[model samples]
Target: MVFNRKHIENLILVTVLTTFSGQIYLSPTGGTFRLSMAVAVLTVALIHFRKLPVMLVCGTVAVTIPLFRSVVDYFSVLDADFGDIFRSYLPVVSFYISYGFLFLLLSIREKLSHPLSFILSLWLCDSFSNILEFSLRQLISPANIVSDVLIQIILMGLARSVLTYFLYNTTLYYIERYDRSYQENRYREMIMFISSLKSELFFLQKSIVDIENTMKDSYDLYRHLESGPQKEQVLSIAKNIHEIKKDYYRVASGLEKVLSAEEDRSSLSSREIFDLIRENYQKLSTNRQLHIHFEFHCRTPFVTAEYYPLISVLNNLIINAVEAIQQYGRIVVEGRLEGSIYRFSVTDNGQGIRPEDLELLFIPGYSTKYDTVTGRMSTGIGLCHAQEIVENHFGGNIHAESDPELGRTTFCVMIPFDRLQEVFIP
Candidate 1:
């Protein structure tokens, strides 16, 4: 047998449990018939707890249970002689020692996964151990060991074995479910954190593309205005834009490095992503104290490598829904994989857009919200940016539908499945 600190600690635990539970027994005062919970406990502990070294623990428990009980018995009845007290309990030692060797011959660990085989092994161990103890008792003082006693022992052993088997499997069933639930929650948290990080990264990257276009257009204007009266002014504007572009480029590059330094955690399950999006939006708007209900209509899981842009697009739509609502509303985010296309819809019960404005929602600098206090229109670029990413990066299209009477709006995005998976750098 092998041993380690952990293995020894387990041995000690098994011994302590066996000794204490062994004390709770149904034994007739002068008869050898005995039934103890300790037998069931020892079988369960040894079988279920794979870390314990079986032979060593069984040997230790065989000695500990009998010795510990005898010492406790001697002290409890101070008037009784320790020798007779120990001798009367002597047959139990043979029972445990024989049971351990018998269990070793059975290769108990391998049978655990097979419930029927496991129960049979336990029954054999318990029945044989009791017979050994009764035989030892007969040796000390002659008594008839009848067939009736044999039948009773076997029946009791079978009862305990069946019960242990049921209890172990039932406990395993619950534990498995708990672990899956814990893992699902953990995945949601991790995706939320990554979504926050990569969403910012996406903004910086998108800005780089805009800065490049601005720089090129400015340089072209400078060349066209050369030798003209406004030559110096246009040249100055081009140089200034170049400097700003350089700064933005450096920042975007640094963020790219920060993301690339870690392992590739690019892809995530769509079910958790959808659930997290719903939960995160709900929590962020809680301070509004509105009777808003957030709902997710998709639980089917798919894998996506374009989570960064995907989340950024959904964030804009959800934020738009929040801003649209005043006091009470419901927001539902739904996703479906249809044929070769992945479709997502964000629907909300808010102040709906007019039919004319629906076509203009994706246009840059177009928004329906007007700030009365400041006498200014909102920045209005959020939907435009989402459309840009969906159309350009994902090869997808986004559109809006509004039912003015019902006061509801739904923004749907549909992308080819292959396009989303192609976005992962690694």
Candidate 2:
């Protein structure tokens, strides 16, 4: 309906199949032209009104042939037996009616957007049946125009259907490819905006450092002034400026790399990772009481992954798990090593997922969080980006298992030793 590449192809396939119906002839130019015009008009109308009800409309419109053909005969303009010509096309008319009924039923029951593709395919298969019937009739008696034309029409219909298959699939491929390209471009633009903001913050810090150094030089020169009563006032002013500079430097240093987690050069042992988790748990504000527990069984010396991203992923997962819990509950983090792979799992006793909402969880800009007062909107890009990092950047896999009724959920991630190969940034 949106006329995407796939939809356009479906339209073309329908047009081709409809055109095949016009190849059946009654021996004269006028009769063939009239029949072709009727089928062509019907095909155009069907393309516009693509719904179950439209199929019935096509059959009703076909009834115009009898009424209009009678009027044409009154003028004696055409040179064929009108009655024989009508009977000759009666099989095609019956086939069209049956096709409409079958297609309408399937469309309504399946809620399909383009049901005619399958129906047209099935109808084309009837060509072989039509061919066999024509052969048996010709063996018993002399072949008539109706039988000969029916065989040819059936063969043409089969060929058209085969062509439809190739065209439709190719169109769908291009449509999906275009959709992915547009999305990737948008993602790159967003990353560029974030990087620019980081550069600005870095420059602002440098300017603050310069101002502090200038104030220090001014204070040092004032201290060397010859003995005078205003010396104390100058000393007090200088001290005040020095204290202000100290406070500014303290605040700026605390904020250094606030948006990112601390990086550790040494590979993290299981004990070190557990200690870091406990330290973070104790440092949480008084308003939140998050009970963190872990069960690490890995005997490996050290893992290849950096500590911060691993910690950041776990930190965010814990925070979200805590938020989802309406009351106090346990959050479990477990780690294990199997062969050359490391597996980490987090489990929470929190509000879980709805069956229908599962598929949408990892989609960018889709969130289930509701505002406390207005219950309005939230952009759910956090989990989406986190999953992207784990899968695309870390070459690991993450899976969620949730139970809404029981108020429990578990997220599992598996990282192979070969994840070092995924270190390159894109």
Candidate 3:
């Protein structure tokens, strides 16, 4: 609840309103002010609460008195007396409450540029209801008020349903369109990151190779010496150079592994994924700490894929998860199957993605980190590549859920096991 800002803002607004209630009542424009308060409350409730329908219901109840009076005054429903105007206006108050609540609910769940169309629709519904009432009064003066109200309610509900259907589809279309742009930007970022990492590895390899050649020359000189104090010094120097060469060889070996893994990264399978992660993280112990917890919940044969590419998927995810933590942190990996669908998840306990940041998390070059801190080298390609591998390579889906306060985030990947295996075998 604390992580939700919308809810917190709603609470603060409600508290301030409570404190100023008396002042509002005494003001000349108090009646209008109260109506404004009613609208404000409904908007706050709709935006803040996930249970929008329930909030809408509460808003309806709170404004019932004013709405009922609004209609009563308009129709002269009550006996023509001192308080009769307020009574006649009651129905308008009710209409306003119901109409505002529904409009707010639709606007939030289904994004709209303006409330004009929604307001127009409500007006149409109210007009239709009034027409029905006027028609009933003319045809049958003996009819009960309960039956009339029920008919009006049913008709208005149907109109709301029709409008909701149209609005919902429009919102979904806009969301999907926005997501596509997000993915394209993410792809560009990931590609740039991969390129930079490749270049860094190449430079390290060249340096190590230069050191290796110097050591080889020194060893050759030491091999041709006579026995003396100089011989002993030469021997010691030779040993030292051997050790240095060995260390250089090790670094070169690690670089070779990174490069090899990069080759044909589009193909990899379940067990290969484990091997790739283990091998990569095993070498990078100087600057980063990586912890992997893998769970296998399905007792089935390994699903096959393009071996290297699949490795890239796991490799990219693990790297990003580690980087996100920025310090000592754990990366939890889990795998399972639901019928023929395979699910793989990686979770990290880190400074999780912020709410505003979440929408652009996958976008390219949109890092929240300072370039110096992250070495200005990260192209943010890992996640975008991971997403691509899941969706395009394996025909799967990838999604992320995060809680910044808890410092935790999880990425879920769903793939069709049978189809992937068939492609691999074929």
Candidate 4:
């Protein structure tokens, strides 16, 4: 499989940790017990990580080993001369440097994806590092360069290669299984959320219809009342009716937002989607006493797509624009077709986003609005949810540009027409 930069970095980190864990010091010869484990770790790392990180990890391990040994020796009661201690460390230093360069060379020459290629690369590097360490030891002590020592190095190299081959594959198997389970759980949660949204929409639509009828009757009775002593009472009742109507409208609008979370499987015109958003926001602005203007321009109106998500994204942008303005501002929405992409933009004249905060706006649970009295976030998921719907469901991308000095911000979304075509045609 192809590996990305993140995957490569993880592999390097894993190799470094495994190397530290597998270390075992052999007495008398001053060699490490599982030096072959480093070969196995390097083999796995080369398959995933790039040469740069591999080299860096090797350098890190080389430095860390000496420091670790120093700490251990300081605490232990092993009495040895400074010269002997330095002599013992020489072979380790030589082995690490040789391993790094030899691994780099083998990686450049071979494709490490296949097991055989990885094994061959690992064996070649391990053998060379071991030979270099043995030669270094010979220089440190004349009697160390014997036939018996050479044979032991060759035999150890073969054993390490065989051990690494088995261990790496076993570890890879468990990692893949864990990742697969995580993805499946995430998918299930999304499905359940959509199902719950559908049930809520049905009840909300029924309640909205009933409230609208009641509001119409109240208006008719208020208009027919005569101006007399009972006129004040009729007026009071009329005011209560208006207040109730506004409250129900607010409730209906909120329900529509919940409905928008589900996938819209119908073919809806761009105008239809825009009108729905405008009507919803108009009620909100009227209730809140905020002056906001909305404009939509779309030449090609009909498009086959999920209506709820599209409207939801536009609705969120408009809400954010409205909230940005402390007193009053204008919001303009424009939709146009350019080549094979549908471009939609929401532009506003409000307190524009801070330069530092602009990049973090779409992150989940991040909000700029806070209640003055309670010091709590007003809403945190608006932009995050909008971004997910556009990019994940509609195969689109969204970006924002802001001028804080002028109090102007514009958010733009671009979705490929091909994605819409696929849904509509099939």
The model with the greatest TM-score is 1
For 366-420, candidate 1 gives per-residue lDDT tens digits of 9888766797997887798788778877899999999988999999999887876
Runs of candidate 3 with Cα error greater than 4 angstroms are: 1-269, 286-303, 371-377, 422-426
Q: Residue 57 CA error for candidate 3 (Å)?
A: 98
Q: Residue by residue across 338-425, what tens digits does model 3's lDDT show? A: 7778777778897798888777766656666545565665776557666656776578988888998899988888888865563332
lDDT of 2 by residue, 1-426 (tens): 244676556545554444444444333223322223334334333534464245545455445444344445535655767676555444444444654554455442242245466536434433543344344434544344765567555655555444444444465578789989777555434333332333333434554666677677657767787678667667677777777777766666665555343322345555565556644554452345544443344344354445444555565566566667765676777766667777777788888978788778778678778666798766675566556556755688777789998988888877775663223221
lDDT of 4 at 349: 94
After superposing candidate 1 on the true structure, give the runs of residues whose Cα lies further than 4 Å from its correct spot: 1-33, 63-93, 112-118, 137-148, 178-196, 210-294, 298-308, 315-329, 335-343, 347-392, 395-426
Q: TM-score for each prediction?
A: 0.59, 0.35, 0.35, 0.50
lDDT (0-100) at residue 170 of candidate 1?
78
Clashes within 3 Å, all models in order: 0, 0, 31, 0
Q: Write the per-residue lDDT of candidate 4 for residues 3-37, one digit (tens) a residue.
A: 67876677557645645654553333554222435
Candidate 4 backbone collisions, by pair: none
Model 4: ten consecutive residues of lowest lDDT: 25-34
Candidate 3 lDDT: 0.54
**Model 3 error, position 44 (Å):** 86
Model 2: lDDT of residue 230: 69
Best by lDDT: 1
